[model samples]
Target: MGKALDNVYKHQSLAYKYFLYLISVALIVFFFPKGGKFKYEFQKGKPWQYENLYAPIDFSIKKSQEEIAQEQLSIRNSKTDYYTFDGSIVTTVKNDVQKGLEQWFATNTFTARQQRDALKIGMDVIDNIYSLGVFENHPGSNSIIVVRNNEAVPVAPSDFLDLESAKRRVSAELSHSAIENRIGLESVIQTSLRINLFYDEALTESALEQELSRISYTRGEVSQGRLIIAKGEVVEAENFKILNSLKEEYESELWRGNNYYYIILGYTILVALVLIMLFLFLKRYRNEIFKNNNKVTFIFFNILLMVLATTLMVKNNESYVYGVPLCILPLVLKNFFDARLGLFVHVLTVLILGFVVPNSFEYIFLQTIAGIVTILTASELYKRANLFISVGQITLIYIIGYFAFHAIHEGNLENIEWILFGVFVLNGLLTLFAQPLIYMFEKLFGLISDVSLLELSDTNSKLLKELSDKAPGTFHHSLQVANLAEAAANEIGANAMLVRVGALYHDVGKMEKPTFFTENQVTNVNPHDDLPPRESAKIIIDHVIQGIEIARRNNLPDRIIDFIRTHHGTTLVYYFYKKQQEMEAEVDENDFRYPGPIPFSKETAILMMSDAVEAASKSLKNPTFLVIDEFVEKIVKGQMQANQFLNANITLKEIEMVKKVLKQKLTNIYHLRVEYPE
Candidate 1:
């Protein structure tokens, strides 16, 4: 039944996941409203309100003709019942007819070309008709005047100003001007004239002054009968709809800016829940490694890491920022799995969030950098007081992400500064906040979290301090193994620090029977010295199982427990197995072996290799470079022949590298060479 259920769960189609994702996106788009506008209103020397207000005119214009037209309209609309119109007449006149008897000067001019050039300027001036609008009687009252028939032809309204006097004044002004010689009218007829009218304030005030002096003929009294048109064109029926809607749309957009904020809020909640669900799923399979109460703590801390990662991915626009989230999952997983699985998780999360966030290649780069840095920095974070390392990791993230953002956006230093401030704040605050948030989430979801690592490494952690006091020899051995394994792993490009940390805790189970283990004894007297060979072998082989049980009893991480289980591959206990075989010459080799599932992971493989090499190197008689090299080769080769290296993903090339590094390190540790006398 369990197998059937597993098959059913595993075979669920990819199409289902994609369909759910599509539905999620569609819901976000549909629910997030995007039509809102806002306008700024100024009143009483203060911005009274930012409201939904509409303006009829757009005063900003780029075209010269449009600018000129607007300005002309402003002037024309400054008054009412009076219009100033400009019309042009195109005309031709006989050349040289008016320039008569200058007998002494003109007849002696040069060639036709010279004559044409000189004559051109005169004809150009004479060929144009010009009009002007003027305030005739008052500031607000304007009249149009055209110079025609050697007179100012008054185009002012007949009832307003005294035209005779106005015309005389205009004629007198024009007669002595430089343009007077160029004034010649062939034929004058008005074309189209567009007129704008508005109530002139000055005119109204003047009329009040001249209330009694107002010469009213056919038109009614100025104060009583005149229309009060606005200072600008009023918003009328024809164009009102377009302007009103435009204003409303802008208003809606501005006021509804919160829509995006809500989207982010929704995104946050959704992501957190997703991470929590993932944690829970992993927890259900927790029994696969070992049972523990700290599953809630483990899940909580990982979720916190994921949340920090998601926060890093948040951007101003909805462009993809996949790397932050992608990088995060692998880091959390690496704490629980092998490095290869960690990398796979990282890549998978990147691809998944890339689809979810709809980001570009830049998202991948930032996430990848963050993932790599986090993996490197936090690999040893299982140690004491290393939470600050996450902050340092975020700083690296800031630098890398800053350059990546700049590269993607084609930005420079100034953009870099803002990006640094933004991404740094995001990283730091999220990282800091992740701790508490994970705690809270664990409580809420009833989940396990890795945040316990911080507490587990505390100076006062009962188990660690107890191990140090009660089994100092075992404790010292653990430290040595940690160092060796770390070096070896680093040389092979695996997560060296992580391997070392796991090694430190791998033998914690030995604390249960400190006297039984050789390292925990002060003297070199073996406890197994008085026991039968099979009985000694049984006790020796059972330490791994005991260590695994102790790790679970104390709620240690699965990763640490894995090292305890697999660090000693199923090889023969040479001392015990050899003695038993000689005692009973027909003894089966298989019966003398360890309860054997060998190292199946790189970390465990590293631990096993390092543990054997470290212990064996100490027993070398008269240790020398040649002697150490010989021993290193023999041990590594022996493990290989026994197929102990089979399951650990250690490549032959990597094994060679590991051997070289181990030999070098062991030589230094043992002081294999004598120094020359100074």
Candidate 2:
């Protein structure tokens, strides 16, 4: 049992123990309504080869979305409503009648009773006419006939003359009365009244919408045991409509029962299969990532986060499905892993999402194409321009995919949903924000990306600046090592940016005791000569420990600090040990060796090789091309002979390439032209 466990986990840590727990959570999240998968498949405008089908129950026929929209349009075109009444307008007319009558009677020397009679006649005139409410006249017509609660009332240009007719009627009816009173009544009626009606927009719209809600969506119905489509019959629009209607009603049938737990378990198994495959792939080919649960968690978490977003969008509405930024997943994952892994994970996620979305084929196809474009074009992610170009290409792919499928389904572009193109555009704009999001993931997941590595490579950074100030010689040495390692990494197709950053900060431990090292001493005085051999070696080896402390103090990523820990490895400090042995009868060799786990990756291994070669070349007696080339070869060969790079996944071919790069780079650094003319 112990042997089997050892093979599974080479070094058991607390992080590895939680692997099962995290996978459990991932399965729970992936669980959806998936226990019962439809057994049959059919496509519109295609021949059905399956056996004849019968309705399982009395499923009601549902209206297609287009049919529902047309019905609603018809109802809206015929709907009409009116405000019915306006009390404020009646008050205004009454006030106007009073003011006009009082002014007219003030000019006459009429008795008090005459004024009273005059006011009564004017008020009665306005009240009588305005009782019939006015309505908006239709354009290019004489007047409008408004239907108020099944009562038709005609309001015309003649209605404006009602007060005029009222004036003549009152004067004749009151002819027997005094002339002064009749004249006052006539003036008041003309001036006091005008149209006192307006269209009520808010309430009128409410009433019309209330009426619109009554339009029934069902134009027709399909009875139970109805023949939908027979075997080998082509599914045209008529049969397609009936099939869709049946599918809607069948899925929504609650009386048949649904086992929620069984459904969850089924989906969990499906997601587990895909994720376990990912784990096995990583554990076999990339165990470093597999053992580190944080990296695995980061990848799985990204997939889950994307799936959750998609599921939520579908739950809200299927039209929201296109608005989801599915392309953004591959674009982000490619930043940390290889393009193949990114594409694989994206395909799996889109496949799972297919069961949730309405138009599964188009949803998967457009997103899969977008993922491919993202992987192919999103190179040099540190350069903002590359990311921008990749986003534009991804959006263009989505638009073309949408257009092609739209034309295929509708048989023409006439019914194309132009808004879906806008959705793709929005998705591209969201993808451009990935630069900032990279930083967030790095912090949250404790992982680094190429974009962060670029920022770390700057020499003016805090730790690099301290190294330059305290130990200028060590600082210059780090720069040459960075350049050499970068070039070597490029030749081997390793992570060049990561190697360069690692090389720059590998010797930060030297900053703690700078004067003890030969390069930083820069004087006749040797600090190491004053101390015992064991003490001198101890100080030399302590740099790796001190560098790690300082790096962690400044919150450096664990990935970068890996270089400091492994650059020296467990090799002996031969110069000090040999000196101690010649002077003393006996010496303990372990005290003169640096404690290390050795280089464990291509980047760290390259750093180790570059550091040893660059530091040793400074001791050249008289520099020559042949001498420098031999010097580069000897140092790398010695490290290899000691099996220092045994754990790092590097090949002899890659090491030879590194040797060639170092030799050419060192030769150029000290290249001298012939002095024959002088």
Candidate 3:
């Protein structure tokens, strides 16, 4: 039991990594839609690639979205408009007419016969206008449905009378009348005429909506066991619709009861496999990052962020999926890591997204290609112009690739969605945010990127300026080391900017006692000469520790501090050690050694080589090309023999290449031309 506990404690980091992988998988799978994926892949105007297919079960053939929209629009345009006939108004107007006629008759001096005739004419006109139904306003449609007696009756516009038409009718009626007081009768009839018909907005909208709802989403049905399509059959528009209907029905039914768990299991397995592949990639090629749980978490978190963003966009609206800026993943990863890893992670992310986004093939193709373009073009992310150009190129690829796919699917550019171009442009614009995001990640995750390295490499920065002020000699030495290391890094295809920044600050601890270092010693003052060999060695070695304190105080990133820690590795201070050895029979080697975890990265390893060679080169007298080459070889080869580079991931060939760059640079510095054989 104790052994088991010990084993668990020893491998806790490994266990934690597994837990992270599981959690990432769970979170990704959870965000994925719970629907089962359709089994077959088909596209309009393309030949079906699968085996012969038949309808497994009966399902209504769903209409295309465009077809449904067209049907709805037609219903809205041609549907019957509803109007309410206010019968109460007709009754009130008629009563008012009768009373007005009585009052007029009482005031008039006409005979009772004339008054009766006028009243009859006035009532007749009112009846005529009300019979046709007076409208308050003209209906938009030529025909309207008037609701009367709790029943809708279709009426034509000409069949109804507005106030103007009602007046005209009243005038005609009175003119034909033999009443002596024709003008007075006309006035009474006109006053009695009131609009009883009104447009029923609520009823009209409700009726139109009902008609629209009645539109059949499914145009027809396919029976079970019907041969849908044979292998190599062209998936035309009609066939595409039927296939889509089957896909929807199949997936919907597949997600129903016991199958739901199975679907989730399937998704979990897929997502787990993808994440595992990423894990394997990091473990194989980027084991240092894999060991560092924080970096591992940062990578996984970025992937999750992109996936979550894309999933939300897809759920909100599939049409905006392109606007999610998936290529930003590659850009950010490339800035923090390398292009190969960035492209690999981007491809894995896109594959995971394929399970959720529409048009899996098209989406994967476009995004994978865009990621490649981003890695290829966005090489110099520190430069804003380069990033802008890269984003433009990525956008252009998206547009062209999408256009090609669209053209292939539809067999014409006529049906291409031009709005997606705007979406692509939006995607490009959002990709520009990768720089700020990289900066934020650097702060949050305690990671370093090229942009930060670029900022750090500036000589005028606060810490570097202080480095120059107090330890001008050491600062100049650092500059030489930086130039040498940067050239070596570029030759070896390592991170040149990172190595340059590391070289620039590698000896910052020398500032604490600058004169102790030979490069900073001036006026023939030898501080070390006054002390014992052991004390002198301690002072020299203390510089690394002091530099780390200074860097920490100034808030330098751990990555830069790595250079201060590992520039000398654990190699002994040979000068002080030899001096003490001459006096004593034996001396403790640890007392004269720099406390170091050693260079554990290519950049740090290159800095160690560059720092050693540049400092040693200053001791050379009348340096020549061959002499400088031999000197560089001795220094680097001595360090190699001491196993200083064992922890770094650099190869012997790369080391040789770095040596070549260092030798060439030293030769140029000394202005030494190649020797000629006479």
Candidate 4:
């Protein structure tokens, strides 16, 4: 009945898993921009691979973006207008002339003849004033000019005068020039005249901008069937401009028709192919990851996260797309898995983004090179300096790539966008914070990383510190095992850091009753002498079980807790079982054996061997290099003959290498040698 229920559930689970995959892939592809890539990708200096390129539709050949921008600037600078003010103050000066004539009669300061002359000159100066507005030297103009009802009116530099100039001009132009200069009639005319014209700056700006909008953008026409370029022809600046115009017009018209749905379908298939390849890779090389639904979900979740963020940026504008942290994907992946997996996922992500972003060729080339560099440099980021160095290299790679692509498009650095260099700098600075992001993923995804291992390996950590205080002897033994395992793992090309950390915490179960284990029994008295062999074996076997419990309570990662449960295989406690065999004719061997699931990886298996060898090496009374070597060989050989490593994913040659590393380390710890005199 149980088997039948499990079979039914297994079929249902498979259907459910595949259903979720379909939904995830479908949702992502649905939101993708509906378009297909051109049949060929070409560069400015590169030769065209396809047959003669012809314009299929009647489209105008657009000017280069740089050329368009410069033309726009020229138009704005050319039509800039100046402020104009009409001479309405001339009418007020006429009224003031009557007041001045009356005031001259009342004051009696000037003679009747002088008053008549001053009034006549002041009246003439006010009437002769032209409707002119004066301004300082303006840019892109020989003289200050103002727009009047859509016509430009130029003002000579000396046309409108200052108070001193106005006084001198009014006095000099008088009918009695000699008598007017002596009488000083300049003050009377200067006071009556005023600056009636004023410059209106804001109004002029609006008129200039309106004039700039009238310029046309198209350079020329490319009628249908016109050959733009032939096969094997180098795409020069003019050819590139026409090709881009064709590409833009083609995309704009194609996406509006029913065929776009089919384009979406093609994109869906392509994206699905990449994701399915990643899944199959995990199933083959890292089946443990494939089996865990949570891990599979986390990997897909990151891809979705990057895709969503990148799409949002691209949707807003192409310039803002640079701010999206592309390297964060590979940095996060490399922290959790190996470099190959990181690079694989990064390439898939960039390929999908290529369809959404502008300039597909440059985007793909830049991101691919950056992803490769990130994978190669991002190792051992536990040290803070390594993180800085890696981020620096990734940022440098992005800057260099942008320069190379820019040079290809413009044929020189003449049209380089310095803002893009700034954008790459911003991208690099954002990448430096990936260390904190790795910590965030650990909390959010329930994942463990080497950064976590380095933290757990600290002797000052709570668990390790407690072990040292309570079970000094066992603590010492665990330390020696860690040293041996680390060296062995390094020799055999396994995760040396993981095995070392595992060895340190593997014996933490002995902390529950430190005095019961022989390593912690400082007094010569044995605690197990009071109990039966079976009961003593039960206590010994309980450590592996209890160790797992302790590790879990401490919130250590499951990857670490696994080492505690698998260090001891289902093997007998030899000394206690042998003593029972001497007293009883039939001693049940199972009662004296450890309840065990053997090590399941190279690092775990190395830990088991290191633990046994380090503990046994303490029993040699007169240890020499030869004795230690033979002793190490005997213990490792015994475990192999008993099939303790049946499940560990390691080979005979690797085990021999591990054995050699163990002997070398143990001999150094115990074997005595004469010190050389300095």
Q: Tell me how many clashing residue pairs each candidate has.
A: 25, 0, 1, 0
Candidate 2, which ten residues in sequence have the lowest lDDT sum? 134-143
lDDT of 1 at 402: 64
Q: Kindly report the root-mean-square deviation of model 4 from the true structure over all alpha carbons.
A: 4.2
Candidate 1 lDDT over residue span 132-160, tens digit each: 33233433345433334445444555423
Q: Which candidate has the top score in TM-score?
A: 3
For model 4, name the residue pairs that clash: none
The segments of candidate 2 whose C-alpha lies over 4 angstroms from its true place after superposition are 1-49, 82-187, 192-210, 231-234, 254-256, 584-586, 622-626, 672-678
Candidate 4 lDDT over residue span 591-659, tens digit each: 887777878889889988999998888788988778877998898888888788998889999998998
User: Residue 19 of model 2: what lDDT?
Assistant: 62
Which model, 2 or 3, shows the larger lDDT?
A: 3
Q: After superposition, which runs of candidate 4 have C-alpha atoms over 4 Å from their true positions? A: 1-20, 23-36, 80-105, 108-117, 133-185, 188-202, 308-325, 357-362, 395-423, 574-595, 624-630, 641-643, 672-678
Instruction: Give the clashing residue pairs of candidate 2, or none.
Output: none
Each candidate: RMSD: 22.5, 5.2, 2.8, 4.2
lDDT of 4 at 529: 91
The parts of candidate 1 lying over 4 Å away from their true place are: 1-432, 435-460, 523-525, 674-678
TM-score for each candidate, following the candidate numbering = 0.47, 0.84, 0.92, 0.86
Candidates in order have lDDT scores of 0.55, 0.77, 0.89, 0.79
